[model samples]
Structure formats: structure tokens, C-alpha cells
Target chain A: MAGFFCLLLVLPLFIQGFYASLLTMTFIYIIAAIGVNILTGFTGLVTVGHGGFFAIGAYTTALMGKYLGVSMLPGLFAGGITAGVVGFLLGIIFLRLSGAFLAIGTLGFAFAIGSILNNWSIFEGREGISLPHNSIAGLKFGDVGLYYFCAITMIFLILFANSLIKSSVGRAFTAVRDSERAAESSGINLRFYKTLSFTISAALTGMAGALFAHHTNYVSSETFGDSWLSVDFLVAVVVGGQASLAGSILGGAFVVLLPYYLSEYRDFAFILKGVVLILVLLFAPAGLSDLLGRLYRKILGKIVRGQSDVSCNLRD
Target chain B: MFAQQLMSGIATGSLYALTAVAIVLIFRNTRTINLAQGDFSMVGAFMALVFFQVLHLSLILAFVATLISVIVLAVLVELLVMRKIRNADWLTLFTATLGVYYILHGVSGWIWGRDTKSFPNIFSVTPVSIGGMLISEAHVINILIAGGIGLLLFLFFKYTRAGIAMRAITDDVEAAQLMGIPVKFVVTLTWAVGGFLAAFAGMLLAPIIYVSPGMMDTVLIKGYVGAVFGGLYSIPGAIVGSLMIGIAENIAGGYLGAQYKVTIAFVMIVLILAFRPRGLMGGQARREV
Candidate 1:
């Protein structure tokens, strides 16, 4: 897996411009998916408003870079922090509700964010904001440079997420997800873990938004703040396998690459995506990651059986 | 101006109330939010367009056909998809509805093309003055039709056997089943009725806002907020909540600026949920274990 990712990272350098940009976007989406998975999969809280957080991050980075003359590094950090703080406050207010109510609340939040972005003058309203060139130490990071930066950041985030899920906090999250009452009785602070999950998820998503702003060189209300964007994130998480880290990467790649491959059938893309989501939920509820895991085991089992048969023949 | 705005707000609020009632009915019975509720209305509007505009049917005929088609679609969705995943968790069901939402949206776009279609107004466009206040004939008719439907629904729930059975099932599904009521049929019936209400609201809204694939997005959100604010399971509460939302948004648009109008619904949702999660008229908090 490590070797494959390394190859992917380097392959972009050798690929054409469009493919390179596509791969970079895939990486950015992977980070976003991981962020969503932490909240939805690990904590068992569904949010239809992460798009709002993403927009907040993008706008923050764009505004800071454009107005305050902050470079990309600090701008990205500020964006993440801002989104995280917002998420923390929202989670405190929203996590009290469960199931459908929570989903509706998040949806409303996403719409509210979009409305504000579309109407507010400081944010330039519907016209959107242009991002300054991403730079570090007076060195401008163009397309290739930004791709490398995103890839490295994605790799680090993946590792960090992996370790986080394996830690005590992750266990608490899973416990809360499975049974909140049981988790509470077991001495897990449900509120704390839930809020923590939201914070971490929002921070990562915000960072991805920062990267997206720099890549697109523009931040708009429609792109990041729309409720449909939140649904898209949900689709990616479910398609990849909600519970698995690798699922996020696979889901991100699937989502990003599907449009490219189906560019000719642009009109049918949404229908196809909807069909995929339904089929996956009905047949493979665990998502594509579980299917991949099963396939891997099956192949390994066959290889081992063949080796054993060859050894037995030699012994005879 | 205040009177006119209030009257217009009431007119729009009636539409929201109808949509909310549909949403509340489904949620009460099935425990699913039906995220595709808006798409259902969108499809209904298109169906009406096809009937009235393409087929050149009379207004009443077009309305009836649209309602029938919407009911069939809703029933098919319930039987084919929702029933198959009856035991799935709330989140899975929600996601499934979202998938359905996307499919409906895409199908409408594919069939109707992406452009907005102008719907011929069924009511007179002339304004009628009541004392010093002026109101459009269409607005008056809309309020009357919506109110009439609400009253009819109220009587149906109160007097009809199926409506009584539906209430029983919503109160306790297993208990209702044990009492020999066809639980599955009632659930399906509830969805059909929901479809009817959504279609009716959509047809009414088409003239004011042109029939488009995305026309019901804001309406659905407002309706959902209303339902939640009124308490998800209560019919009367949903209606009252929707009226409040309608009036509030109009006032906000008039005073604060039109841009801030939509944000009012969202802010209301957040504030209401934060302060009272169960909604205004919800009975008791049933904490999920």
C-alpha cells in the first residue's frame, strides 16, 4: 500500500497537466473524506453541513492571503483553526439532537452558510473571492509545487487519522457510536468525544478547503458552501467504506476520477452516482473497502493453497 | 403594506404548511425524514406541466393526473426501495432517501431539460382590494385551497377508518399489527397521501415560481424546518410552525433585505433545535439507547 501510494505521488510528476491536476484533487478529496469519516463513521454522527466548514476554511485562507498578505502555510493553519472552532461550537449545540433532527440541523447550517456567503459584502457575495498565489518563505508554489505539498500533507493526515482511530479516543468514539447509553455507563464522556470528533473532522476538512482554494485560485459560495457538496462528501465516505481509513482514499479517488471518466456522460453522472450509492447500501453496506478486503483475502488464500499443494507433491 | 405582506405571508405559509404536513405524516409513521420530499414535489410540478401544457388537459384534469402519478411514484419508491431496507439504521435510511433525491433530480433534469419552464397561472392575476389592503386573486385562491385541503385532511384523520388505523400504527406499530390492522398497507397509504400533498403544493407553487428541477429546494427546507419546529410527529404543530416560518421570512425579507430571507429558516432551525430538540409540541423525549 505504501509502495502504491509512493508510485501515485511520483506518477503525477510524469503525467500530463490535466491528469496531474486531477490526481492532486483526488488527494485533496481523500483528506476531506477522512475528515468526514471520523465524524460520521467513527462517531456515528451524520452531518450534512461539512460543506459549510469547507467554505469557511476556503474563505478564511483566501481572505487572509489576499488581505493580510499571509502566506499559504499560516493561511491554511488559520483556516483549519477557524473551522475547528466553529465546529466545536456547533457540535456542542447540535450533538444534543439525534438521528433525523441532527441531519436536518446540519443541513440548515450548510444552507445558512451558503446564504451568508451569497449575501455578505465583505466576502464579495455571489461574485466570490480570488486567492493569492500560495507561497512559502517568498517562494511561490505553482501547480507542481502545490501538488507535492498537497500529497505530502495528505500522507501525513492519513497517518495521523490512522493512529487517532487506533487510540483510546477512537475507541471511545466507536463505543459512543455503537451505543451511547452503554458508552456513557462505561464512563466515556459522550459529549467530550463527540465534540472532539467534530473538531478534528472540521479541522482536516478546513485544511483541504484551504488547499482547494489555492488550487482553484478562487473561492465561491456555490462550490464549497452548498448542501449538495455536503452530500457529495457523504457519498464519498459511504462508497469508500465508512469504517476503514483506506476506504476514504478509495472513495476519494472514485469520486474524483468518476467525473473525468464519465465526462462524456455528464448528464448521467448524478443518476449513476445515486444508483451506485443505493446499490452499495443495499448489497455491500460496509462499502467498497470491505469488498476489496474480501478480495485480498481470497487471493491470498488461493496463493497459499497452491504453495501447499506444490510442497505436498515434492514430499511425495 | 404591513397588511399586504401579512396576507402574502399567510398565502405562502399555507403552502409551507401543506408540505410540512406531508413530511410530518411520513416521519410519524415510518421514522424516515424522506429527504426526497422536495424532489417529489419537483416531479409533481413537471408532471403537471406535461399534463396541462403538453397534453392540453383542463386545469382540474391536469391536477388530478399529477396527483395520481405522484402517488404511484411514491408508492413504488416505498415498496421497491424503502421496504427492502426496513431494518436498516436511521442514517442508512436517510442516505437511501438522499440517493432517491439525486435520482429524482437527475430524472427530472433528463426528462424536462435543465431550463426553467413557465407555468400558466390557473387563477386570475388581477389584485383584489379588501378595504385598503390589496391582494392578488391567485394568492387568495392559494390560501383557500391550502386551507381547504388542511381541513379535509383533518377530517380524514378524524373520521376515516384508514386514517384511524394510521394513527394507531404511528402510535405503536407492533401493537397496531397485533390488533389486525394491515401495518404495511397503512405505511404505504401514508406515503401515497404524502405524495398527494406534495403534488398539490407543487402545482400551487408552479405559477408563482416557474416549474424547475430545483424549485422545491428552498420550499422543502422551509417545510422541514417547520415540521421540526412544530415537533416532527404532530400535524397541527407542523402547520402552525410553517405559518410562523412563512410570516417570519416575509418580515425579514421586507425589513432586513431580501438576501437575508432564506437565512431566517436556517437560523430558526438551529435556534429551535438548540433550545428545544423535541420541538414545540412534541410529547416526550424518547432517548435512543
Candidate 2:
């Protein structure tokens, strides 16, 4: 029933322009959360710095558009590539520092990018860069055109992510998360896989950031603030459920919409986040998806039992 | 000019180190960061602000009152809140601390109304001359207070029986529990001490800088940077790490630019963690079981 409602609600998004932008943000957040999920959920690598790659993407697109006179296509790919290279370098060196150290290190990387973005004159020195719409492969997406473009892009990214997880490579990533000690004995190069995950995750995040900068038409250092990065993207996965792509999208939707609907009680917004997150930590740490999954199983079992009882009565 | 910049940075860094040390003390004792440290300090500063404004108490009396209030707040918070989660998972505990942060931010905003208050001038504004290089009174006092706090903590930890017991528990809580130490009680005491340190640092620094509710938000970031750099478990490391980052930031800001100042600590830590994951002084951190 809930799924039916979701489909109904999501249907307008396919037809309307505003709902498209909403899903555009959701898709972007999906990329960021998936990046973080691969590290935290799959590899047990904690990061508070996905925003750094995000900023790198936004900044790259803005810079290319402003200075290089390059179109948004190259700018978007450039954003992902830049973040991917940096993530690869960072992963190769810092992959071994688990838990708190890893969390802090990622934070440091984000802070570093923050400093550069704030200081760099080409990035407009904290005033922020306004992005122009792209002319993609001679097909320009202006105004309402974002609706179809973003929806299709999100579908493709989700499919790609799904395929990646289904491969043996995905299991290898999960193995590292579960137990690196055992994985080492099984010839899994933990360091290599960890780096691969970081790079792949950053690329996705970069793409999302580029889309965001292009969509909103603004890119600034504040967009990558530590608080938002730590709270919104990281918590979205937890709030939505981790290690699942559909859950990632759901998490993205919640993070964006929850704050929007509760904007009237502005202060209550974060207070509610704290409360809900605490509940998630305590009773439903596996996430909304996991909670719903459990309820579904129980209801299904009851239905099966009731049908069986009716059959017995008919047999008698 | 170089010496002056370096000195000022170290002075500020010392404060970060002091706060980081207190945070480390709490983490070591109870395996929690006590997200309320910033709040405890802010509350103390606010208390001092009130004592000075309303009752016209001497600065000395205000400090004493502030310290007492901070300790009391710490105890109440632990008794009412943290004790319930003694056996919680690290992530759950982490979320709990974040809850504390949100609550503190809310309460502080409610009380303070997001205004910056001018703290009394603890020192004269004139620069104190040293070999013709002018050092502001703020810089001098900041360094002296930070150093004094560091020394006082060292003495408290090294010379007292309760301090040794705290150390013992920090090293091995299960063993300390088995050895007849009231480990839970000691953990509470650790929180109290940590609170006192944060409040003291906040008060002393308040007079040097302006007092605002969100002031510690940035300070906390710097303090965490200092803590991580110094090795979260090492008191001396916190001090050394704070000073190191402070100096590096000063040099970086002086040469590289002030816009990049905030990144120095983070950039430093990332490089260091990549090369030295256990931190500069930390023993090998155990991999997750």
C-alpha cells in the first residue's frame, strides 16, 4: 500500500516541472549517499568528507564554464574525474585509518577544499559562482527540460550502481567491510579494493555535484559545509537504510523533503533530525528499508497462515 | 613580523590544545567525546558574564563561580544523560553526543539570542613590548592561561591519588573495575574535570575575544583538529599538536593567505594520518574486531 502511494506520488514528478527539480535534488543526494554508503556500509570506512568531492565537482563545473569557455558536458565529466583522482590518491594513502581517524581525515580533506574554494579568485572568493545551463551534445536543457533529463540520468545511474553491486567486485567490497583480516587471507587486496571504492564513489558524487551546480545555477563553498555534509548525506543513508540503492534514493528524498515540509518549525527541523536519528540508532539502526522489510515479512507470513486455515476448513 | 605571527598563532593554538586536552581526558576516561564540552564552556562563560554584569563581582570571584557551575552542569549531565549509554555502540554513542550538540546549540541560542557580548577587558589593550616586537595583551594572556591550565592538569594527573585512579581506568576499564576501582564513578569525575577545563578555557578566551554562542562552533573544530593531530589519547600530544597546527596555520596564513588558514589543520592531519595512522604519538589503534 505504501509502495502504491509512493508510485502515485512519484507519477506527477514524471509530468510536472517542480517535482522534476525535487527528484533532481533527490538523485544528486542519491549519488552522494551511495558514495558514502560504499565506504561506510560496504567497506567499514568512515568519511565525513564526501562534500569535498562534491565541492570539487561544483567548483570544476563553475570554473570551466567561467574561465575555459568549455561547455557543461566537459565540465561535468571533468568534475567527476578530478574528484575521482583525488579520492584515489587519498584512498591509497589513508585507507588503513579506520573509525574516528578516517572520519577526521575526510573532514580535513573537506576543510582543505573549503579553504581553497574560499580563497581562490577564479571561484569568485566565497561570493559563489552562478552556473549556466548546458548545451549537451547540441541538445540544450533549459528550464523545464531538466525534468526529463534528470529523471533519465538518475535511472541510468541507479542501473549502473545496481549492476556494479551484482558483480563479484561488489562481494569483494563487502568482504573487506565484513572482515579485512579474513579477506587478506583470501587474497583480496584490501588496499586496492578500498581505493577502487573511494574512486568510484567520488566519481558518482562528482557527477551529482555538477548536475546540482548546473541545476541550481549556483556553486559556493557553503554548499559543502561540514555540518550539512555530516548531517544530510551521511544521515540520509542511515535514515533511508544503508547498502541498498533504492534505499539510497529514499534516503535522499527524506533528507530533502523532511526539512522542506517541516520548515515552518525551523528550529524543530534539526531537533527532529536528532530525535529520529537517535531512534534509528537505538531501535531501527538498519534503516527505514530494513524496518519495512521486517514488517512485510511478518504480514506476508500471517496472510499465508490465514489462507492455510481457510483451506483446512474447506477440506473438512 | 615572522616571530610575531608565529607567537600569536601559538598563543591561539595553545587554547585549542587546552580544550583538546580536556576533550581527550573525557574520551580516554569514558570513551565518549562529551559533545557537551562546548556547551559546558559556553554556560560557564555566560555565568561569568552574568556575575560580572549583575552582581559586579571581581574577575577572580566570577572565575570561581563559573568553574563551580561548569562542574555542576557536568555532573548533572552525566548523571541524567551519559550514564544511561555506558555500554552503547560507538556509532549510537556518537549520535547521542550529536543530540547533545543540537540541544546545546538550541538552548544557547534561546538564552543568548544570537548576539555577541563584549567581555570585560581582562588585560589592557596596549601591546606588551618584547625586544621591540609588540605583543598584544590578549596574546600574552592567552598563552599564559593555556600554559597554566596545561601545567595544572599535569600536576592533577601526576600527583593525586584520584588522578592516578582515573589514569588507571583510562588504560583498562575492565581491569580497573576488577581491581576495586569505582570505574563508573571515576568516569563521571572525568566528565566533570573535562567540563571545568572547557569552561575555564572559554572564560579566559572570552575576555580576549568576543563571547557569542556560536563562537565555540569554530573553536570546537579547531580543538578537534588539535586533538586528532596530538593523538586523541595523549594530553601532551594535544598541547603539542595544537601548538604545531597553530604555528603551521600562522605560517600558512602569513605566507599562503588567511583564506586558507582553516584548511591548514585539516590538510596537515590528512597527510599525517595517511602516513601515520596511529597519529604522531598514538599507539597502534586496534583494528575493528
Q: What is the lDDT of residue A172 in candidate 2?
A: 89
DockQ of each: 0.68, 0.51
Which residue ranges in model 1 land beyond 4 Å of their true spot?
A305-316, B284-289
The model with the greatest DockQ is 1
Model 1 TM-score relative to the real fold? 0.96
Predicted model with the maximum lDDT: 1
TM-scores for the candidates: 0.96, 0.89
Minimal lDDT window, size 10, model 1 chain A: A307-316
Writing each residue's lDDT as its tens digit, candidate 1 over B29-51 gives: 88888888888888999999999
Worst 10 residues of 2 chain A by lDDT: A307-316
* Candidate 1 lDDT, A62-145, residue by residue in tens: 999889989888977898999999999999998788778888888999999998898888888768888777789899887778
Interface RMSD of 1: 1.5
**What value does DockQ give for candidate 1?**
0.68
